[model samples]
Target: MEFDTPVLDNHLHLDPENGRGMEAVQDFARSGGTHLLVVNKPSWTLGIDVDEPADFRAAFETTIDIVDEASELLGGRAWPVLGVHPGLVSHLTERGFTPDEAGELMQAGLDIATEYVPSEALALKSGRPHYDISADVWDASNRVLQHALALGAENDCAVQLHTEASEDLTEIADWATERDLPAHRVVKHYAGGRLVGPMPSVMSEKDRLAEAAERGEPFLMETDFIDDPERPGAVLGPKTVPRRVRWLLDEGFDDAVRTAHVETPRRVYGIETLG
Candidate 1:
């Protein structure tokens, strides 16, 4: 079987602490990769010594700085997707913060078109969705998402999100449709079997993808895979990645998967399209 080299890596991380850096990224690209989406987390959220308040803030700032600098330095070579991760949100709650406050802050990140979402409450209870925040929290989250949509429109940034289920994305899709926002403006990230649940339902990933296809909704393909094994989370298996792409191809939806992962993300970040 023949395969194509990626013009871009739609989702990626580069951290010195994690042992991923410029060299590693370059090698990946040289081996037929052209672009990368560098995923960064705020330093405060970095899993360093979160035992102290100072450590937390440092990690947070570091993440912000990394995004800014990488955007400038990488230029057409790499792009960025910013967000406070769901896992990090859980960690913050364990450290201390009212659920309402946590939800509010998470929305603030969303408002700016941050790349990820707080899938659920701390302790990582993702099995139980948390769309039912307090009224105030819901309003706040809505306002932020609205602002994010506007920013994404202006900057050509795609809003990368992680949801407890596909239904959680309906409102976003509706909003985009109501406003006539471009399909490529929003790229649902970490979308797969993980958050979509183990059973078929209205909220399943397949249902969501079919809906998106019918409505021309755009979505970037992301593995949401991590290095950890003990955690019941989205694991990006190298072998699985190509297989998923192949599956989409077989489904007659290869263009969506390729365009989302390659064209849309690069265009948003002002990078060259992969040939």
Candidate 2:
């Protein structure tokens, strides 16, 4: 299982506040992973106060700080992917902000995140799934995502999105299309076989890999590792993608291995092909 290009784990959450965060990364690295692209979030706020506006504000700041901590932990071997996760918007509503107000706050946070684009961020990850949120709130989240896309457009950065895995990512692709963003710059995170745009973080399904390999454009891969000990390896582990991808490569899909594991990640997340 030799990779001609860097074997990058394109998406995972590493809790910079906890020691296990880097441990998870180190384990993956020891398993032949070259680098990782970590998305920053304060999931520790899970048991904390989401009902208090002040508490939520503090948690939000902590989320921002975690991105910095991650940059240091991976020692430039990893890059930070920052954005207002869709759950954060819903959480704001729980804290008493209206959907519109939460959208506004999401936009403001995205603006602040954009300032990190040239300094600390590798990319922006807008849109985290919102099945529990109301339709109006979901629409509001889309509005915030629009801001994030625009920010990426302005800064020449890439954006990986969180959304429903459905018939296709038509609506999201349309947003990027309407704004004239390059197709390669938009990533559909947590994606399945059906792709609507470039660089989907395709899940650990072999059929999905076969499907994506047939497509002309290269797709990215991810385990979407939540890294919570309470439900460890809920979706998949950090080593899953690299291990499975290695299998695909051994099965004679060197091209898919190169495209998904190498080119797509570099194009979408801006990581070099090697550490």
Give the number of the best model, judged by lDDT: 2
- Candidate 1 per-residue C-alpha lDDT over 77-98 given as tens digits, one digit per residue, 9 for 90 to 100: 5444554454434544656755
Clashes of 2: 1
Candidate 2 lDDT trough over 10 residues, lowest sum = 49-58
- Candidate 1 residue spans exceeding 4 A from truth: 1-5, 19-27, 42-45, 48-76, 86-96, 103-147, 154-156, 177-183, 193-219, 227-234, 237-262, 266-270
TM-scores, all candidates, are: 0.56, 0.85
lDDT of each: 0.44, 0.70
Report the C-alpha displacement of residue 228, candidate 1, in angstroms: 5.5
Error of 1 at 80 (Å): 1.4
